[model samples]
Structure formats: C-alpha cells, structure tokens
Target: MLFSSSSTSLSSEVSQVLSENIPSRSTTLTGDSTQFQINEDLGTEDLTNGLPKKLIQLKKLKNGGTTIKKAKTDLEYCYDSLRLYENPYVATSRDKKSGYSIELCLDNKYKTLMFCDLQLNTDFPVYYDSSLENVAENIERENVTPLQIRGKIRIHIDRDDQALLITSQSISLKCFTKEYACFVDSGTGENTSSSKIIKELNNTEFFESSSYPKQQLKVTHHSSSDQKILLARGTYDYPFTFTLQANTFPATFSSFFGKTHFRIESSTSIMRIPSKPKGFLKFSKNENITDKIILTEEIKVKRVLPSTNMLKFEMFQLRSYNAASDVVVSVIGNSKLIEIGIPFQMILSIVKKDPSVELHDASLAVAQRMAIPSIDLKTMDILPEPYIKKSEYLLRTVESQSFDSDKTVYGFCFDDVIIPNYADGLPSWFKTFYFEASSFYPNYAALKVTHLLLFRINYSKNEVIEGLEVRKTYRVTVNFPVFVGDSDISTSSLLPKYEKFENISDLQDEPPLYSTVTVEGDN
Candidate 1:
C-alpha cells in the first residue's frame, strides 16, 4: 500500500505512478484489516525539477562550436584574470611584411586590460581606409542567446586583405522599466531652453539624442547632400509638448512585516509649452562640424522644483564615419546598452580607461558618456563592459586616416562625457589617461592636452610620409584615474555592527571557537 490515511486522491495517483516506474518496489506501509496504509513524509512529496533540467538544456544547445553557455564566459569576469599565449583565448597582431606578431592580453579582474610591449615591422604596407582593409581587431562576446553562444567562434575578414577582426557584442543585464519617450532631444542649440518643455520632477541624463551632459540637440536628419540648408542666422521660436510617467516609491515603510519586499506605483502627467521659445541648430551642407556656427538661447522653467529630487540632464551626438548618408541616433538609458536607432551587426567599443597612462587606477577614470559617430543600423557594433576584461573597456572605435601601401592610418579621439560627482566626491585612487595613435611611429608628432578634459595630436606631414611609407603598425597607450562620489542613499556602504567582549567565560554558553581560543597559546 502506497497511501496513508491522510493521502489525497491526487497524491495517491502520483504515488501509484512512481511505484510502477521504479525497477525495485520500496514502500512504507502497515497492513490493516481492510487495506494497507503508507507512511507519509514531506521529503518525498516534492515533484518539481528545475535545476537539472536547465543544465541539460544548456548542454544540448552546444553544437560543436565555441559555446557561449559553457561553464566559463569568453570574456573575463574581472581585470586581473587576463592572459594571452598561455590561456585558451589569445589576441595577436601580425605584421604583413616581416610576419612578426604582437600579443595583447585581456585581464578580467582589477578592471585593467592591456597589451604587452608591441613592436611592429616597418616594411609592411598599412591600409588607411576606415573600411578596415587589414587590421587585427578584437571581438566582444558577453551576453547572447543559447544559439548565438553555441554557434562557431566567428571572425570577420576583410575581403580585400583577408585581415581578421573580432566583433564587439554584449547586452543589458540590469532590470529597468521603459516607457513611451517623446520630444527627447539632447541640450544643444535652442534645445537648451526647452527644459521647461519637460515638466517631470526628475530629469534623466540621456535625452532623445546625445548622451553627453553638455550636448543638447538630437541631430535627427543631417544631410551631406547639396540641399538648401537652414542657416544659423537668428534664433527661431517654436512650440512643443511632452508627456511623462514616473515610478513611485512606497508611501509607507513597514520593516517588520516584509523586510526585503517593497512595491512601487507609477504616475503620469502631460506638459504643454504655451509660449514661443528661441534656440538654434544650424543647417549647412558645406562646413565641417567643427567649423559650423552655433547659436544659443534660454527658456524659462515652468514647473516648481521640490527640495527632495535632483534634476539632471545630458545630451549626445551621433554621426557616420564612412558613408555620408548613414546616421546613428542614440539615447543613453539607465541600463547598459545605449538606445540605438538600428538593429544590425554592430562593431562596439566601450570607452573605459587606458591602463598604460599614469594613474592609481586607470579604468575608473572615465565612467562618463562616450562619443559615437552615426552608423548604419543594419551593421552596428555593441560593446559593453561585461563583454571583455576591465582593461578592455577603454578600447573604442576610431576612423582610419588613410591607406599607404598596406599600412593604415587611424585617428582616435576621446569624448567629453562627464558623470555627476556624489557628496563624498572623487575617490583618491581615481585617475584618467589620454592617448593618441598614428599609422606607425612617426617623427615630430605633437599631442595637445586641453582643459584637462580634451586632447589633440598634431603630426608632421613630412615625417608621416617618411616613416610611415608602407605596411606598418603601432599603438599608443595612456592612463588616468576614475572619480567616484559616495551618495548618502548609495547602497555600497552598509554593514551590521557587532560588539566584541573581553572574557568568554562571563558570557553565556560559548561556541566551540570561543572556548578553544586563548591569547597566549592553544593546544
């Protein structure tokens, strides 16, 4: 008998199934005058299985390829856990002329990733086309689907030169709620005065466009085509409206009942601007972006500010490097991925820190927004911190300068992105590094450091022609410290306080460790 006096019909059915399935019969029963009764136990009652099944599915997903769901991730978990030749994954840069190689390592721990000493052969021809004729690049693999993870370790090759590059890829891991966002523009030109256009008590750093706090206008339709452009002659006034919804916190706090569980309610509002406001966004097809004239205007804040909440705003700009037509529009989100306009193969780079630069810790120095050029949505790259080692986070994309023989000339720039400092402000260990690279090591090159926030490099045209004639490669390295402020409500600094007593015997019944330990010696 498998049933006890308290057994229900459903339990009896399941018990009968289990009894028939097992090869050997083992039952807890006692004979009765009318029937047999089974003993009840809670341990044998649970029929749910979730853990083992998940592992089995993960194994089945692997199909003779570099499995993304393997026990370990291809990207290192921290900065210190990096390797090159010794590890299963290695990154190498090879010279086209001398056939020499340079090895770069990815450190997962310490947030510090770097390449060892790099020495390139001067005879190889360098390709300067931004189209990537022949340069060794790193691929990022962090978060992906089981199918994508189990697929082959894919490497992209330039059809012209057969040079291989690893693409950058990653996804958001944090949980965030999104809503219908409208009239979102980074603070730029006249958009700066439009803060009153949004009436919510809270403002996000990411506008509909630029991700830079200082940048304000979202450049929507930029055409290099020879079209009649709107010149920046005067400030123009316009009308705009926006609707917003915010997440609400619990009105009451009850720590005794549910310590960890808390619920939040959501509220929404609509804002309309009745007055004509002045702002500027110049439209000229001829002038390069740097030389374009800029106009500024101010708008009035309509809503009242509450003393409790802080209002923060940010702006960003996106442009295309290769084709004149392709443009990328991005908004910074509370989560990992920047809200990009397109969905396609992307080459991503996370601008973190330069380990080679001077600093206590280089990676933490630039935890601000990064500048990204407009790109086709169909062929985009997604790079985040988790996809690579901490040191690699600082690596970003740059437009190649020119192609001389097989050598490629590249131009690199850092964004003027900034994050707000907390009350405890910038940690002592934080630092930031600046770097500039050329086609090969050229003679008489100059680097300009401006505002402690910007950097520029000038090269002698004659020296570039002489030293960088053909296939060659070189990398410039820099480093800086990261700043972190401690917020009052920040969860990073909370711990329980415990008291220590002098005597063990005076206390109540002691634990084994307390009785066994003595100041002088323990036998």
Candidate 2:
C-alpha cells in the first residue's frame, strides 16, 4: 500500500497483463489455505485418480502374462487422438506365419517408416541411395498386392490397464471392415441380403428366428497411467464375409466369392485382444527415462574374454587436451603378465637372424621366448612392434581377412616386441631399438638396385573362394609432392629413380592417364 501493510504493489506491465483490475480485499480469507491447492490443467482426463476399473466377467487361461476373454458382444476401440506407428524388423524367409518381415526405420521427422515386402533383384546396384519412395514402391510391386477383398479387425485396450474397461464415452465402432457378396440371384437381380444369406446357410439353425442388434460395434480405452491418458477419435472400415457352402449357391452363381453380389456387412463385436499402452508413461520398475532426457550413464560395456591358447595383445592411442598420445601393450600368456611401453624402434639385423630358420617358425619362436601362451604363424598382430618394446603394451592377434590397405600403408602393422612391467620401478638395463622398412620399388643414385622378389607357398580353398569367386581387387595409390619453375624441357633433369607414371604437371586440367599391370597365373 502506498500506505498500508495489507497491500502495496505497482507495476504497469503486471497491471496490464492481469486485466488491470483490482480485487475486493474485504472478501479474502486471511487464514484460509485453499488458494494454494490449485490443480494443474493438463488438458486431458486427469488419470491422477487412476484408470477406470474393468468389470470382472470370466477369466481364462493366460497366454504368457496376458489374460484373454471373449467379449459378450462385438467390441470397438475409439480414442480421442489416435496415431498409427510401425517399425521394421529384418525380413527372413523362415517366418512361416507372416511369410515376410517389414523393416521399419525412423525418418528425420521421427515418423516410423516400414517396408511391407521387398525382393532383391539382380539389376539392383551394389550401392544406392535409399529414399522413402524408391524402395517402398519397388518392393510392394515386386512382392505383394492388395487383398482385393480382405480386412483386418483387432481389439486394443485404450488405457494402460491390463484389464479392458467398458466405457460408453470412448467405445466406438468398426475401425476397419470390408463386405463381400456370398451369392446373387441373377434373374431377380437382388443382392442376397445378410438376413437372406443367414437363413439359407443356417445348417445349424441357431439364428432361425433371431434379429441382430443395430449397435453392432463399440471401442474403449483404459488408462495405463496418470500421464498416459486415453486419446484419439476416428472411424475405420474393414472387409468381412460370412461363412458359406457351395451347395447353397445357385448353379449359375459366380464361381468366386468376389464375383457375387454383396452388400457391406455391419455388426458390432468388441475388438478385444492383449492390452498394450502407447503413451508417455513408464512404470516405477522401468529403468529407462524419457527420450528427451540427455543420456550420461555408460550404456554399453565390453568384457575381455581370455583367449583359448592363442597369443594376444592390445594397442590404443588416446586423445588428450593438447595432443594425441600412443600406447603399446603385450600379454605374456605362460606367466599371465602384462607389459606397456612407449614408441621405440628396433632395427632387425639380417646377420643375427639364422638363414635356416623358417619365417613362420621364427615368429613362433619369438612369441614362445616371451612366454606367450600360444602363437599361430598365419595370424597378424595388431600392436606395432616398436611401441610394445618400450611402451609396455597389449597385443591382439588379428585375422588376415580383417587387414585393410589403410592399416598396412599407414604403418599400423607391427612385429612382436616384448616389454617388462614396472612393478617396483623401471628396468636397470633400459634400451630401445627401431626398424623402418624400405620403400617398395626403391633405387639408389648412380647405381641399379635389385628389383625382383618372389615367394609362394600352399594356398587354401577359402582363399581361392574369396579371391576368385568374388573377383575382389583393390587399388594401390601413391602421392608425392613436386616443385618446378618454368622450363621448356617439361621433365626433371634426373627424376626420382622410380617415376612409374607420367608427371601430372603437364596435363594442367586434363584427366590423368593410367597404365595397368596384369598378373596372370596358369590354372
């Protein structure tokens, strides 16, 4: 108050936003706490009280944990705001019931996309971009067609309650249905009505004098949680047919059911099935959070299983704030010891190497000397030899099939080198060695270098299958920098000894020419 303790506030913006009106202070209750208990307006039926209860009728055996029941009459499922979504799973030929699987993926807009049926054609390229229509249209045409007269009917619990709730407000009719003629009187030109068909085919005579009800369908939703409210309001149609017999039809009637005259059938039955809730609600026992929340917890962990006799090692390069650091590790199998080291090179001397020692045997001997559990000659080690010597590293044996050109060309392959752990401190006789391989197609100035080298041994059937059957081939490329000033003789006076291709500087903007070297082997 400009002058009293009871009230004194003045703000033009607040006054205008609040209707610029004054309240009667005389009517306020000074001590009453009712004003603080205002309920929030969530715009949906507040399930804060819990889901509407289901009336218990008859209970049957449970399938898994779900209970099944026969509706006293036809059922329907109606929602306030319904949204249909689907996700795809891998398609396999072994699925007998469904015959196929629809692969569903989410689009950028978070819409669920599914491919009903797809068949890979020979003309399909090895790689192609996938757009929504490209694959869907092609696959649907190639593998599936509309059931000229078929429809699907399903019952769903609108709310999260495991029990179905019978609510007149939410229950509605025929989400989907179809009607097909069973018989037609050609001379009379009258479509056999549902009542007529029932009379003619009542072999059991159960419906001899019964009249079906006009309200043939209804649907409802049960609240799954306080937040998962019932929503969606819409109608759907489906194709349906009554059972028939060949003898009941006249001799001239259409042979196929589709050819006969028929009217859309309308009857209501509860679409009762397993209760599944799709809403923004989760149980207390569920560990997952809303997708809108940022994930900070480690979601995945990989365990290292002990190798079954094969020698092993591991290596990694960790990134730091300032720079990248290298690490090496090795495992001594017999002793069950680990070693780590830093980058160090070893120059392997041919003099110390025994000429009689076979290459495969030599590698195994080296591994055994280091107390490695086991060594396979054909397996390639992923750890670089130099790092293992001083960096104290772990090693893992990798298969040749996993080798890539980048790994080989980027000095990723390494020889077996051993390092000791520092249980108490560094070793007393600490020394490191390094070895760098000579480049391929090398030569020396003022001299000719030996360029020929060849070696071959046993080949396995698996290798032939991978090489010849698939016709796998890879390209090897080399890039080197060149510097030149204007000169008429467009060539280096004495180019680097191994200039295998024409210099690109002369072509300016033209595409570079290439030469191929074909290797042949007699079958």
Model 1, backbone clash pairs (residues 3+ apart or across chains), number: 63
lDDT of 1 by residue, 31-111 (tens): 121111111221121112122211111112222111222132122211101111211222322233311222222222211
> For model 2, what is the error of residue 357's alpha carbon versus the real structure, in angstroms, after optimal superposition?
24
The candidate scoring highest on TM-score is 1
lDDT of 2 by residue, 1-523 (tens): 0112111121111111112121211111111112222112112232222433332211111221112223222222121111111111111111112111111111221111111122222254101211112322222112222111122222222222222111111211111111121122223336643221201212212221111111112112222231221111111222222221111111111111111111112122121212233321232223232111000000110111112211112221321110111111122222111223322222211111112211110111111101001111223211111111111212222334432322211122334433443453434332111011111111100000011001111111111463574322221111111111111111112122232557766444643311111212211
Candidate 2 whole-model C-alpha lDDT, 0 to 1: 0.19
